[model samples]
Target: MPTHFIKLKPSAVDEYKAIHAAVWPGVLAALERAHIVDYSINHYPPLQLLIATMKYVGDDYDADMKKVAEDPETQKWWAATDGMQESFATGATGSGKDIPWWTEVEEVFRFEGTS
Candidate 1:
């Protein structure tokens, strides 16, 4: 399971929210096909930040990500969504490359519910 923190431009907040309100079915299917589960996206209005959390059930994160990226529908979705995001600062991600968007944050703490 992994959680990611990302930021959105203030001007694009409304458009981003509106789009996610009715996400395309193919996008959802792509995520599931990538072995991604428990996906959630949250917004902070004041900061215009979006935090995404997901459990990756697959063994290979990179490979699953590549599959997701290669999906035509997913690419179309990103084409519409990418412009609303802000890129991470250089050296902000482990990839050693400037991430096009959504900077990854190191989780500092977590509390699990006792079931």
Candidate 2:
């Protein structure tokens, strides 16, 4: 299992929190089906910067991402929230591009807890 990290800043904390409060069920299920686990998000208060972490068990990162991107429901979900993001990079590349608001980070270490 490998941990993945990403950074981004949503337009507003309240708006971002409200959206995640009720994440689309289909998107959640799709992530699970794609072998993504331990998904978590942390925020820097006032700054509104968000750090997302998830564990990926798949061997091919690009392939797994492609599967998630091809999902119809997920595409529709992105369409709804695309405008609410403040991308770190320029150009209107939409969501989940190599250059987007959320930038991927290399993981160094991780420890699993037993529930």
Give the clashing residue pairs of candidate 2, or none. Answer: none
- TM-score, predicted candidate 1 vs. hidden true structure: 0.84
True lDDT of residue 76, candidate 1: 88
Off by over 4 Å in 1: 91-100
| 10 residues in a row with least lDDT, candidate 2 | 1-10
lDDT of 2 by residue, 57-104 (tens): 877867887788888878887777666555555563676555654655
**C-alpha lDDT values of all predictions:** 0.78, 0.69
- What lDDT does candidate 2 reach at residue 79? 78
* Candidate 2 wrongly placed segments (more than 4 Å): 1-11, 98-101, 108-115
